[model samples]
Target: GGGGGGGGGGNTSHCAALTHIQDCLNLAFSTLDPISDRQNAPPAHTGYRVHIHMQRSFASNERTASSSSSSPSSYFVPTLSYWCFIPGMAFRRLSAYRLRSIILTSGTLSPLSTFARELYVPFPIRLENPHVIQNDQVWVGVVPVGPNGRRLCSKYDMRSDANYQDDLGNLVIHFSKTVPDGLLVFFPSYAVMAEIIDRWKTNAGSMASFAALRPSFSNSGDSNSHLSSLSTWDRISRNKFPVVEPRESSEFPAAIEEFRNRLGEGSKGNQERRDEGSNGPSSSSNGAVFFAVCRGKVSEGLDFSDRAGRAVIVTGIPFAMAKDSKVLLKKEVLDQEARTQQAQIVNCSNSNKGNNNSMSNSNNMSNSNNTNNNNNKNYHAGNHTHVTSPQPNSTSSSSSSSSS
Candidate 1:
């Protein structure tokens, strides 16, 4: 009897395909001996290393009621990645030796020597031109204290404090009221931004109470009555429409469009007020405040020129979390490399000292030999003069012989 059943042909083909894939993977991995070695290598030797990361996720498809009662469906995904710790290696590969030339230009490339050293390349010719804009064109100021006279510190420990959050919110409110057009506020991270926004909405005695005290207005004539009826968030939103940067890439376009539209509306309102000869608070312009994370989409490449970005307020420095596995690994690798470089420099200095000592000793020996040779020549000359002619006044004969 033939062994294959109805679906047996499909199973055979799938098995053959899997076997072929396995063979290919084996051949590829066999060539990567260094990567194989790195699997067991210590942190110090992890300059160029491969990391295996495990990701667990639930199945996207919903399980049947019968199956759900038994166990949830989930799977583990393993990802292997190779990382190069030395940034200089990349630059060296693309150096003048391999290519014609490498040119790097940036507005923020200050401390050029450090940058060049890190790249392991020498920039023989360098130019640093003066800024195109004059001093008065740009204005920079640091606000040390918040509206409540509390020190403005966005350190991780202080971020969760009630008083700190309230003061920070108050600072934002103050800026929102005063700064016309679009205000871009950047937080350290998405998580931090979310936490601050949550606090602003929920904290009864903080932002809500504060907003209640401030007078708000509507387009209608009864401004005081309208202010009393609005909620805390409504009061803040009325002053300026808030646009938050979404976490998903798919939603980014929509968020950006909303921000731009709000800006356009605010600009139109400002023009109308000016035409009517109305002298009112800047908040009356109905500008938009964009809340975005530092180093995110908004802060990275997007240009918010003119009225789109009147002021940019940075809440905190966007430093990487120290506890992250990748960060820790990178830090360890850099430290080890730094230590190795320092050791090489010290050894080189010691070797140089040894060479200098040897040279100095040889010079001293040569000088001594020259002195002895001169003495020997003098002795020989004296003996030759004595042998050639004998005289009763030896001193007079010696003087005459030397003079001759």
Candidate 2:
């Protein structure tokens, strides 16, 4: 997460590395007596071992690479070829211009490369190693696909969480079309990764919220088993953040409207459904969990077993990725201190025109937007009627939505 040279002087890295080692040793001593630690060593310690040998070995190499530079110039994502790289590929250039896009500098999408090499590839074709091999095949085969869907999108968007936020402020569909149940994760932004929570608050406390529902999907690579999170295909959804601030009493109409809309939907449908909770006497079997996430907070680090107990609705995209890499870099430092691998996704998501390439992604949604007379005129409807068919399972978005 630390930009460019990774938090300055070589001393910093060495100190951090030593501190990490010390902490690990201390934790080992404190958690288990030496006698028991040895017995459990194979699973707990050995299992978590990584051959940072390469990373260590590369220190001098990296230093040499950094100092050996023949030219005085700038380096960006494409040059490092980190975020722009596919899982596997033989890198051919190290200059910034050679990178994928002019925008990116770091993130989950960045490629791990040997700055020591002329090209970013390994010193030799050690692609036989499983991680290397897989990465190579992906780079050679899949990476070339628009330099790979992940790298391309990541390089460009900056903040591209797949979670789909809904019109309702508080409810967002993590994986569209798949309605969830009980205390939902209100990602707002992973609920899109920005915190549309404010949007939810505005909706929850505003004067005009009509049957609002928000939804989203998380791309932290979490599996459903851990917390019943949705997969791109398994068709479930995931994660959480925080809650919404309840509205002032003046928000009654909006709350009432939301209530009326719920009643209308529940009553107009199946028989016993009228009593399905929110409105009538019984709650619908199809329920949702509500999670509230605040921008610029520890939303991602904490895990809630009840992740999506109900269903999450989003307010708006949460916080735009920070302008510089400071916050993300600090997070990386903290995660490392605790011997954890937290995802640090950097994004440039403040663009006004969000990418709208997949409006039809969801199967459940029949309508995309609620057309008013002014808006509908463009669609030739002549009258201001609402279009209600939303795409089902449309969990991802480019996030061009306003809190409205």
Candidate 3:
């Protein structure tokens, strides 16, 4: 991603796009060549194919989009992607044949047919289980209209707006106080999260008060002061930047140890203290507020059970970056494949119907051969009869989805 005619021109504008492409290339080349080190090499039994493709990425400028006087402008970023392809048989060994059974699941698996074909599962027994949790356990709300009556949205166009940040920050502060323990707030990307955090810390005074309510794990529950109260986070942020001299290597681990001590969730000391009925400042204080990025490590397979997590706040739907070269190519390939398959299915259906019709005609012609001399002409005409090919389904274009 890069600034699209918004930021100052030249190097700064290209930085984001360059960084993304560089990271992608690094990953590709890391495994591209066979190394002498056994640990670094691909499995000996696996067969692999490498693909290189050039993709044009256009940066989406959110600030420009929100401006009524100016239209959104995009800057083209050329990217080269290296892809590694392992055939379905490789996956089949581990998932299909190797495993006793396989279960594929997701919260939004609507239009299940697409998944069936993509996963190569010929006949899938799709099960959409009814909600086990009560309706009250789940809460859904739309973004409110702005003071000027413009409908609020977290789309690319609106996210950078000052009004949007204020609205979102207010909501966060509200939920932080009203909601119970262990609230998980997810942002679309780290850049967005960092920007919001910076704004809240600098501009929004309410956020400071809200931050004070939660206990910090930077120290060993000894500090109760507001800024100091956000101890673990404070130390992490300090370490990340150079406002002050960085601490020794032991500081991070020590800070983490202090954090675990407060959570009473991980180490033996905290667990033991919890069993002893001592309401340590960490345990007795208000619960944790975990800020995470969508699709990050926290959102993967980890279960936040019991008191660990009470509620989750998703600021917006996390859509894949459209301008990313690899992303665009993958979507294009899937859509093309879907259309091809649909056309093939239609052609096969037409062929089968035509064959049945010709068989019937041949039978009738044989019967009429004994009576009419023109029966041969009729048979030849029936043999020469053609059926127009079926057009590809119109809906296939929109039905394709990103590969899992």
- Residue-level lDDT of model 1, residues 1-404, one tens digit each, is 25656468879889999998888566445433332222442332246556788865655553321111322356889966555665665564465356767788977788899787656667898889999878987788899877666788999898888778777777777777778878998999876787777666655444434444443412334344453454334445766888878665666787777676666534554565576666442433477888899989898888898778889999899877788667987888779768977987999999999999999999999999986675445345543543223346674343334443
Give the per-residue lDDT of model 3 (tens digit) for 154-201: 787777776676546555544555555456677786556655555544
Winner of 1 and 3 under TM-score = 1
**Regions more than 4 Å wrong, model 1:** 1-83, 95-97, 144-151, 202-208, 211-232, 265-285, 321-331, 364-404
Most accurate candidate by TM-score:
1
TM-scores for the candidates: 0.64, 0.20, 0.53
TM-score of structure candidate 2: 0.20
- By TM-score rank, best first, the candidates go 1, 3, 2
The 0-to-1 C-alpha lDDT of every candidate, in the order given, reads 0.67, 0.31, 0.50
Cα error, residue 224 of model 2, in Å, equals 36
Candidates 1 and 3 compared: the better one by lDDT is 1
Q: What is the lDDT for 89 in model 1?
A: 57
